[model samples]
Structures are given as C-alpha cells and as structure tokens.
Target: MHFDFTDLRLFVHIAEAGNLTQGAAQTFLSAPAASARIRALEAGLEAQLLYRGNKGVSLTQSGETFLRHARIILRQIDYLRDDFTGSDSDTSGHVRIFANTTAITEFMPEVLAKFLASRPGVTIDIQERLTQDIVRAIRDGTADLGIVSGDVDQTGLEAIRFSTDRLLLAVPEKHALAERKSVGFADTLAFEHIGLHDGSTLLAFLRGLMEKNGYDRALRVKLRSFEAMCRMIEAGVGIGIIPESAARRHTKTMRIALVSIDDSWALRERYVLVRSLAALPGAGRALVDELVQNAAGGRK
Candidate 1:
C-alpha cells in the first residue's frame, strides 16, 4: 500500500513493454534487479500483477486494475509539472485519448505526427476501447477525451463529428458470399469468422453485434491486423469484418472481396466524445481542434 512513484512507473513500463528486461531497461535497471523490485512490490501489495509466460508477460486482472490507477496518478503528476513549469503562451500538457479500433488504426497516426511536431512539451497517450468504456473513462477523469463510432448513446458527454467509419466483410474471391454486393451482419454470423485478437476493440464490437442479433459466432482464428485477417480469409479459413478503409486497401493486392455490411450500425460517423470542451487542458483542446480541422480539410 506504500508504493513509491518509481515502482508504479516501473510497473507501467513493464506492462506496456510486455517484457521485464525491456521495461527494466527503460527504468535504467538490469533484468534481475527489476525482477527483485517487482517481487518486493508484489509482496507489499499482496496481489499478483503480471502473468509470466514463455514469450512475454501479460497483465493479470489485478494488474489491469492496478495499471489503470497507476496511469491516472502518473499522468496527473505530469500535468501538475506542466501547469507550474509551463508558460502561458505554451501549450504544454498531457492528453490521453481512448478510441475505437477504426480511429486508432485509420486516422490517429498522421494527426498525432502533426500535433507533436509543433508542441515541444505536449505528450499523448492513445488506447483502444469500446465506445461505452471510452465514455465512462472520460466521465471518470481517467481519459481526457475519446473518438467513438456508431449511434452510441452519449446522453451525458459532448459528441463532435470528426469522421465516418464503416465495417465490411472481407471474403475470399471464390467464397459464396463474395459475389454478393452486400450482406447482412446476421447472415455473415453463421459462417466461421477470422478476427482480431480477443482484446481488440473491433472484435469486441463484432461480438456485441452478434449478441444484439441473438447469434453466437465462432471465430475460427484470431490474428493481430487487418491484413492478417484478410490473409486468413484468402486462405479459406473464414471471412472477417474490417474497416472499410482497410478492406479497400487490402483488397487491391490481396485476393479478397469487400462486401458491404447491410446494417445501420455498420455505417457510423466517428465522434470525438468528451465531458466538456471548456474543461480540457490546452493540449487536449488543441488535439480536438486538430481532429475536427482534419475532417474539415477532407482528411477523414
């Protein structure tokens, strides 16, 4: 219960890096030293934090909860440092955004690049999560803002239109459904599916879609990226649901067909969801401006 900032930060780095040696190196400690420190920390907390594996470590359920609070505390410290040390004209602060998979994979990289170039003291952290979770995190002060999709209920939060998102079924060229121009989400559910990993936001959304339609799906295999999903589909494993942008991009080279998902929820306008625009820090507001301005400039 009496953990110091160093141990908390060490845990964050370890959880993010998924490797003890790499995380230790970030904190300028050796592997053995980091291991001892982690053991001591765990002993003090009386809770296991990480699940060790042959390839790397993953967060236990306790670790996930611990990491969330650790991040909030660490980020608040950074914000406090910036507030007192930063100049009035300088936009210097930390902005953490929780977004869905489409926003993370398709839109954020270039915006982040441009945002970072002019602001020397601004830092950003982006995580993928379900839109419902994103809204809760924003309300609870765990996240500065969020980018969400679909017709999700945002009764309490401010929603700004930033971009559009659509999900398409990626089927192999010779598959029975590929010849069809469009297919309903329910129709696709009966077939085995290839999907992103279990924790991916897109996979979670697809699962929710299935549940909403009162269908149970079997994901034949799970991979890390859209391309991998396309590859699996091409190899006749199963069809996959991927972002329209990704489907178009992958279909040009891969032997896959993009079939529209004929569901209202499949076609969605992405929104920047926040508690209040006026309450955001300068850096956070700047990021919001960046997103909407990009959309205005036809950069969705």
Candidate 2:
C-alpha cells in the first residue's frame, strides 16, 4: 500500500542497468542494501516486481507498470519545484487597490480592462474608500496602491498625478437650477438632492462641504454608481453632485443638465499613491504603469 520514492528510483536504475549491483552503483547504494529495500517494497505491495535469474534481473509486468507511473509522478514534482523557484518578476499574483468613488466608477473600468487583457495570470481587488482612508490603507500596507483626490496629507507616500476630477451639479433638463451657468455648493442645498449610497467617498466629501458651508440639506434618494445617480437626476428624482466627467458623459445620451460648481474645492487632482513606487512587486508595478499610461493618454 505504501512505497518510498527511493524504492521507485532504485527499481528504475536496476531495470536500466540490467542487474541489482549496477543499479545499486547508479543509486550509490550497496547491492545488499538495494536488495533489502526491494524485498520490503515488494512485500508492501504484495507483488513480485522482478524476475531474478542468472542472466540478471528483468521487469515483471507489475514492475513495468510501476516504472511508468513513477516517471510521471517524478516529472510533476519537478514542475512544482520549478514553479516555486521562479523569479519575483512573476506577474502571477493578486494586486490590491483602494480608490475613491469617482476613480472606482468613472475611471478604473477601462484602464483595468486593458491591464487585465494581457495579464491572464494577474487578478485585481479594488475597494471604494474615502481619500483619507485610501491614503491610510496604502500607508499601512493593507493596500498596494490607492487612487485618491483633493488635498490629502501625503507626507510619507509616493503620489503620481493621474487625472483631474471636478464635481458638477446634475439636474433634470427642466429643473430650477438647469438654466444657471454656475452654482455654489451652498446654493444647491435648498433643493431636494439625489446622493450616492452610504459609505461612498463622494457622498462623505459632499457632506463635509455642506457642514462647513451654510446650506440646508435634503437627500431624497441614494444610489450606487454615477450612472445610476445621473439616471435618477434625469428622472426628476432630485439634483445630485457628481463628477463633471460623468455628468458630461451622461449628458450625451440623457436629459441631464450639468451646472458648474463655482467652489474651488469642487475641482481636485487625483493621484496614484503608494508607499514606494520603486519597491512595488512586479504585478503591482505593472498595474501602476498601466494606470499612468492610461491617464496620460486619456481614458475612452
């Protein structure tokens, strides 16, 4: 029921050498030592593996079957060993990303698609978080990279500027604020508004702005994505503030009105943050490069 790998190798050497002594020499074992091991192995299997004669030993049908299987098993073990011994440049692991809501909804999808197309072995895990939380996660090593916006303290991280993000007021085409060329964040608070789902980074940022500025608040609905928020705004659910890129993009096909925010805080530059870009693992570096390239060329 059980035989060691040594027994298999010894049996194979003996079969190729055409005798026990020569096979023992090949395996660096004495003839008597090899004979004892073979006897034990045969006993364990309860099969006569060799036909011992004056001309030397030859494989019985059982020995032939064992040799064939032994070679296959040895080859697989060698492959496993080689895989573990491969270099760190192997882009075959997981890459963790923490990003803000706009980066997750409006930015990452196309960029990630291009990155994943050629890296069949690479996988990505992304989570949406507030900018400060994303920065903290990257610093603490829980995340490999982060996409964040606005004036966050980046004292110990590597920040690579990737894109500009501007928040705009999205309203129905015939809504009260639709004809306005621009509106202040405080001005929009008087009307009912749509918002992102709870825990969204954009919603948190907007809430902070509303608290800091003198503005009444009314949130009638909360949805998951910018697309959904735009749809709600178009349906006259309420006006919502979302990324300008999303608002403009959605306007091409939806009856949504885009109103510029006069507040300077509404426009912020987004960055890719890492503890140290040069020290990233191969897969991580590749993804960072993909993001930088996509940003420079602009995403479709």
Candidate 3:
C-alpha cells in the first residue's frame, strides 16, 4: 500500500523479462540488485510476486494482479514527464496576442499560421480589441504581444514597424464614386462617409489624413467594424474608408469597388508589433522575429 514508483517499475520490469537477470540487464542494474529490489517489493506488498523455475520465472497469482496496476502507474509517470519536458524546448506553452478586428481578421491569421506551423506544440490565444485596448493589454501584462494600426503612447512598450497597409476608399460597385480614378479629401467630404468609431486608431489616422489634406468637417458613420462598413457600402448607405488589405479581402467577393485616395497624407498606415519593454520569453521572441521577417517579405 505504501509503495513507491521504483517498486512499481521493478514489478513491471520483472513482468516483461520474466527473470531477474534479463530484467537487470534491461534496466542497467546488476542481477543481484534487481533480485533484491523484487524481493523488497514483494516483502512490502506481502505477496509472492514470482515463481522461480529451472528455465525462467513466472508470476504468482498476487503478482498477476499487481502487474496490471504497476504497468498503469509507470505509463502515467511517463506521460507526466513527457508533458513537462515538452513545455520547455518545444514552445509548448500558451502564448497570448492582442489586436483589433482589422489586424486579427486580415493580418494576424497569416502570421499565426506560420508560427503554429513551426511550433505545432504551442497554443496561442488571440483577443480582438480596439487599438487602445490592445496597447492596454500589453501594458497590463494581459497580452504577450499586440498588433495595432497606429502609434501607442504607453511608456513601457517597445514598438516596431512590421508592414505598411494602405487606407482605401471603397464604394458599392454601382455607386458613383466607384468609377473615379481617385478621390481627394475635399471630394470625400461631399459624400455621406462610412467610418470607424472616433476612438479607433483607424479613425484617428483617417482624421489626421483628412486634416493634412485640408478637410475641415467630420467624417460620418453609423458603425465601427469593416464588415459593418461593407454592409453600409453594399446598401449604398455611404462611401467608406478602410485598410486596403481589408477591402481587398472582404470586398473581393462582394459588389464593391476600391479606389485610391490622392492626398498629401501618409498613404500607408503601419502595422506595428508591440511588446513589453521587459524581457520576452523565447517563444515570444521567436514570434516577433517571424512577424518582422514575414512583414519584410510582404506576406499579407
């Protein structure tokens, strides 16, 4: 009843080899040592675990019952060790990432796919939030990495430029602006525009782009999600501005036409990689490297 795992291992070894000498050879123990271990286990369990004969050894009735339990225990320990060891070198632990809807839907999937393909044992948890929420998650230690569209003001975060995505004007295929070669800031203002929420970094960037191009009025919209923006455009509710990547993905199958904006504004917005200024785990570092390399290679 008070047996340790070594006793159980001795029992299993004896069961498989059916003799002390052979079992000792398999386990790298001397024959005498292996015999002593089996004798000690039998004595502790108060069961004659083996019957010695001229040719070999066979299990007694009590040994037959104990062998079943012994094998199960050894297998369980093997599994426990394998699980712990895997978490070390194989990047088998959990990693968390935060991003807004655009980054999650359009960009993060491709990056995650590549990371997962290489580190198949690792599990990733992704959370979608607005830009401010994404930064806040990193600052609060709730997320290991953050993907956001614009600059974050948090003090202890390290940000790196990964890729550039252009912001585009999209309209329903039949809409008047759909056929235009390009739209200017003044031209956009004349339309009932679809836009992200005022708090979104996309909205902030769009506002700055408008201001830089000398548009003095507010851009109007009833929703925040690109899907919602698409729905509005499909209904001809208004023309909308969105990341070109998003437009390309969601609108390709829809009746939408994407147009470029010709303004003095920064034509491309950045997709930035952010992590705590504190040290990152090896897995996180690997992920960051993959993301930057993929970005440089122009993958999504």
Candidate 4:
C-alpha cells in the first residue's frame, strides 16, 4: 500500500511530539482524529509502527525504519511547494542579489532605484561580495542574481554583457603620480601598489596582467574594499588601481585623482549579469529584465 503525504506528515509529527494530544494540537486536529491517522498508516503498511503508552507514544522498530524514508519524502515535497507555489501569486517577493563592492557602491544604485520604484511590492537584499564569492553564492542557491566584474568559470550559469567598466589608477591629489594625465602599466607598477584583496575579480585580472608583462613576482600590501583603499591612499598608504566608477567618487569627495592607464594592454572589462539556468522566481525575472534594459542604455 502507498502512503500519502498526509500520513507521512502525521507520522513525523506524532513521532516528534511523542504524544497524540500534543501532535493533534500542533496539527489542529483532535486527539481521536490523530490516533485514527496513526492507526490507518500502520495498518496500510501491515506493520506495527507505534507503541501506545501511559506517558506518550514511541515508534516501533518498523516505524523507526519507515520514519527515515518518510522524513526524506516530506522534505522534498515541501521544497517543491516552496519553489512553485509562490511563483503564481503577485510578482511581489524577495530577490537576493550578490554584487561586487565596486558595482554595489557605484553602478547598482540607479538601476536598483528604478527597479524598486516600478515594483514597490518586491523586496531586495543586496550583499557586497567578491566576484568569485558572488558566483559561488549563485551556484549554492544563496543568491538569485549576481553582478560581477570578470568572467566566472562556473557552469550552469548564463552571463549576459551588461556594461564596460574602465579601470583607473587612483592616487592622492598631492601624490607625484597625480601630475600625470595618464599613467602606464609599468609606471603604476613602480609605486608601492596597494593591491585589492584576494578573491576579487579586479585583483585576479591585475595579477594576470602583471604576469603577462613579466612582473608576476612583484608583491604589495593588500586591502579589503576600494572604499577602504581610497581612504588609505588619501592617508598616503599606497596608490591603487580601482574601477573608474569607484575612483570618480574619490576624485569628487576627497583629495584624490583618477588617471587612466595609457598602456596598449589596457582592457575594458565587461560587467556581467549572471543568472542560474535553473528556475528563477518572478521577482528575479523582473529584475533581470530591468537589468537588461538598463544595460542597453549603458546603465546611465
């Protein structure tokens, strides 16, 4: 005989509470109804599953074995309902987005504001993470979408071209490098470089570039975020190579200068919109459309 989900749920609940009265209270059923369910489930399987006692209920050896499979089946059904049922309702739901520090601080504000204005019912949770970590978050089902600076090598994710981000050499205004309108790659490398922390796409790209130019062995101090690097540069720690978007704010608010790299090796990295090829919720799809539209407009 096959067991229905109702039976499995009743079995698990009764096993947990150890008493039909409490289990019935939890399921909003009377004790009689709950006891009848337990009996029916045991009889259908042609095995004794429970032992009625003066104090509470206990699972028989057969019940103990069946409980394992029953729990697994019930959990899967719950996940199916969670993924499909909420999709049909209002497009109002939560979207978890992961973005690198640069995109979150600079490129994402305007686009997110516009999206939120259009979908007032949808809530968004944004996390500032490194590019590699952002990809991992999507792969692990923690985030629905991601905006990253470099290529993510993970399979099962589709990355769409969003916008081109120009890299800039950010220096303090009083620094000697600020006198130059543009700096070359070799010149930037000559300074005490304040490197971005590991796991960042920017850091990875920079390391690759340095390697291509036969400067792979060079070492530098590491910092966490571009914002923190900017403060350190202002404090005369070391010059940093940061995204143009992040550099623009420092140029305006602080005693900092943004200089483009004049090397022919300069590359315009594309900011990409990443989504899992698997199922996505309504709010996630809406946000993706908004991102694509915004990207077409150059993310102005």
Candidate 5:
C-alpha cells in the first residue's frame, strides 16, 4: 500500500532489463539488496510481479498491469521535476515504440528524425516487431506507442491510419513466374524463395500464410534487407516477396521482375496505436501527431 519512488524505479529497471543481476547493477544496488526490495514491494502490493527464469525474468499478467501504471507515475514525476526546475530549454523524457518492419523500414526514419530534431532532450527507444507483437507490447505497457499493419485487430487501442504500401513478388528476369502479371502466393511456393531474416514481420506473415495453406515456406536464402533480397533474386538464388515501393526501386537497377501478389492481404496499410492520446507522454503525443500529419499529407 505504501511503495516509495525507489521501489518503482527499481521495478522499472528490472522489468526493462529482464535480468535481476543486471537490473540491480543499473540501480547501483547489490543483487541481494535488489531482491529484498522487490520482495518487499511484492508483499506490500500482495501481487507477484516477476517470473524469474534461468534465461531471464519476465512479467506476470499482474506485473504487466502494474508496469503500465508505474510508467504513467514515473512520467508524472518527471513532469513535476520539470515544472519545479523551470527548465523550459530541455524537455526530456523517454518514449518506447514498437513498430512492424514495414513501418520501421518504409516510414519512420524521416518522421523520427524530425521529432528528435525538434526536441533535443527527448530520447526514443524503437523496436521492430510483428504487428501482433507490437499490439501486445502496447497492451502490456511495455511500449509507449506502436505502429502496426492495419490488417491486424485494434479492438482495444486507439488507432490512426499511418501509411499504405503493398507487397510484391520479385523474381529473376528469366524465372518461370516472371512472365506472369500476377500470381497467388501458393503458386510461388514451389520455387526456392529468398526472404528477409526470420524475425521480420513480413517474413513472419508469409510463414503464417504458408502454414494456413498446410505447407511450409522454403526460404532457401535469407538476407538482412530488401536490397539484399533483390540482389539474391537477381543472381537467381531465389524469388522473394518485398514491399512494392522497394521492389519498384530495385527493379530499375537489377535484372529482376515483379509480379503483383494476387492476394487481398498483399496491399497493406499501417496504423499508429496508443492506449489513449491523453495518457501518452508529451514526446510520445508529439510523435503521434507527426506520424498522423505525415500520413495525411501523403494521402493528399
């Protein structure tokens, strides 16, 4: 019932680090001291906050719920500090963002650069995740904001249209599928495919599609970026699926052919999600504004 500032700070550190020893070191407390503090906190709240494991620690459902409130409390404390200090020159806070690969790769660089330039004291931590994962991170309060593909559910979150891009199948100029104007995803599965790395949202989505069709996608080659995938396809390593914007750019330079994906899901849109606009920290709300404005301008 009566946890102090130190307790909240320590809890935040531990949740972020997901390692007891490391979190303790960050707080400049020994492991034993940190563990005792956490125990006291749990006892006071009558709820277990962490699931300690061999690999690392993770939040329980209650822990996740508590973390959301903890972050809001911490942000409020920061606001109080800024108010008393009268430090208008530097408006500083941390905003954590989780976004899908498409949004990260295709949309965010310029927008983030603009936001960071305007608020020099603000810092952002960005993670690339799949759409569903982004939603979960936002829902769990692990992230301040999320940018996700619109095809995913957004039942409980406030979402705004962010951007739109489509997926295209890229193949070697001489590949059998190259002559086709468009093809189903299943039609391309027989050929060895090039793909982005395993954790990429695009790759995960494709894998899910293959799974739904009762087959495994054979990713014979995996590359780190769209350009790399294009080069692999050019060399006949394998065909690949890539964002149409990237495919159009790469096709001009490489001896590759792009065929429209004959699937409804290929044409994708991105959405920026937040638990509540009013609840977001100053910097996070600013970023949301920038993303929404940019998307609107693009539409015009």
Candidate 6:
C-alpha cells in the first residue's frame, strides 16, 4: 500500500497539536482537505487512528504506533535527500547535539565554530542538559550527538574522549583557603559558598558529597553561569567550586585563587556519546570525526 508523505506529515502535526483545525492550518491544508487525507490514510492502513472529542483530538493506540514509524520515515527521507544532493565539499545536513553545562562552558564553542565555518551548508541544534539527560536523549535517538560527563552510566552508547578538565576550589585572592595547596570538602564548610543553581549536575554532585560526609552548609549565593560564579568569587561574595578550565581563564584578570581539591571527583573527564558511530548520518559523522581529531591532536 502506498502512503503519501504529506498525509503522514499532517497526521504528525495533528497528533502533536491535538486540534484538527490548528493542525490543518499549520500544514496549510483546509479543514476538509485535512480530514479527507486523514480518512484516506486510515482507509489504507485499515485502522482507526484518531479519537475525536469535544475538546480536541488524540491518537488511538494504533495511531501512537504509526506516529513513531512516521517520524522515523520522515527522518530517513531527510537524510536521503541530503546525502544524494550534497557534495563532499559542501556537505549539508542538520545535527542535534545535547550537552552538559561543563562541556558547554569549557568546550564546544571553538570546535563548533570551526566545524560550521568549514561546512556552510550544515546546521546544528544544540541543547543544554545534564549528563544523564543527554544519555537518555542519545538512547532515544532524539539527539545525534551528546557531550556528557564520563562518570555517568553509558552502558549502551559509544563514547569518545572529547575534553578533559577538573573542578577546583575557587576563592578570593586573600581568602584564608587561598594559601592552601589542597583542601578537603569538609574543610571548606567553614566559609560561605557560591554555587550553581539548584538542580544543576555539579551542584547536585557537591550536595551528594556534603550529604555523604554529613556536612551541612547553606550557599551564600546561587548563580547560573560559571562566569557569574567566578565574578562573585572575585568580589569575595563567597568561595565557589568551578571547573579549572573556566577558572584558569578568569584568573588572568579576576582576583581569584584556584585551590586544588583533594577529592577524586575533582578530576573530570568528558566524552562525546552517540547511539553508534556507524549509525550516525553523514554530517554527524563528519562533525564527530572533526571533534575526535581535534581532541587527539590537542593531547599530542
């Protein structure tokens, strides 16, 4: 049986919008045209696809199953179109990347800029998420690539080294902890702390450590970005725990001191993860190759 791509696309839109009129408008089809197409599709499949209610429309059980397959088919068609028409010198496609805060703050900007500069036809959609969320998105095929903390569970994903950076105790230049070469987690409890926003991966990890060691201390302030956190530390608002890469850059002009953490968790290793390197689309594979090559060359 032949299924029209237009019908499949319309079905997906309606399923997502939950309103036939809105979906039809979004797809640029009149209400009657949209209804006829959906009915035709149902006739071809010999299954009820939608349940109409006073409020809106919803997918039937069969519709849910077909929606998943329809999305896959559309994605494959996009890949095929790009592969056949795009040239090696002008490879064109879209890559969806999900990354953690550490990777976003410490890496990715230069690498992505370089990749985009070379591939003018390629586009990237990036989302910032925690490591575990990035892993989940990769497993679900919602993202083509992921950069995540290496400590997270990556049981089914293939990962390559992306970057290496570590967390450090950041303090004001004249703070009491500034003189110490290394300090334990417990020792830092005496001072007010600057921290990332609640629910951040780093903040969660630090909280876990505090709970494990039975240390309780409230944050003096919570900020969103590493730059803001470092600035706060420089202003002596409070000491903070930040990535060494970020701290190193800020310390050039900011009056901040980076003290070593005696904890093993301070040493961070990040990796680029994907469902499978071989399964990635051509553009994604190219970008991944560039990232891996850049990282390897950096080590050398």
Q: Per-candidate TM vs. native?
A: 0.77, 0.69, 0.58, 0.60, 0.80, 0.75
Q: Least lDDT summed over 10 consecutive residues: which range in candidate 5?
A: 82-91
Residue pairs with backbone overlap in model 3: none
Candidate topping TM-score: 5
**lDDT for each of the candidates?**
0.84, 0.82, 0.72, 0.73, 0.82, 0.82
Alpha carbon lDDT at 282, candidate 1: 75
User: For each candidate, how many residue pairs have backbone atoms clashing (under 3 Å)?
Assistant: 0, 0, 0, 0, 0, 0
Judged by lDDT against the true structure, how good is candidate 6?
0.82
Clashes of 3: 0
The lowest-lDDT stretch of 10 consecutive residues in candidate 4 is 269-278
Which prediction has more favorable TM-score, 2 or 5?
5
Task: Give the winner by lDDT: 1 or 3.
Answer: 1
Winner by lDDT between candidate 5 and candidate 4: 5
lDDT of 2 by residue, 1-300 (tens): 777778877887898678999999888899999999999988998999899999899999998777667654553453354357672353566677989888888879988888888878777879888887788777766677899888889999999987788888999999999999999888888888789998988888887887787555557989988899889888998899988888889999999988999999888988889888776666778888887788789662
lDDT of 3: 0.72
Location of the lowest summed lDDT over 10 successive residues in candidate 1: 82-91
Candidate 4, 133-252: lDDT as tens digits: 778766655566888765457577777666777778888888889988887888776677777777666777688777776775554577777788888888888888887777787677
lDDT tens digits, residue span 1-300, model 1: 577888888998999899998999998888998998888888988999999988989998989888888877886776576567664222677788998877788779988898889998887889988777898887766798888888778888888888788788899899999899899988987788888987777888888777887766567899878888888898899988888888888878899988988888888888998888776777888899999998888766
Candidate 4 stretches greater than 4 Å from native? 1-90, 118-120, 154-156, 195-201, 204-225, 262-266, 271-278, 297-300
Model 1 residue 223 CA deviation (Å) reads 1.8
lDDT of 3 by residue, 32-82 (tens): 888888888778888898999877789999987787666545644543554
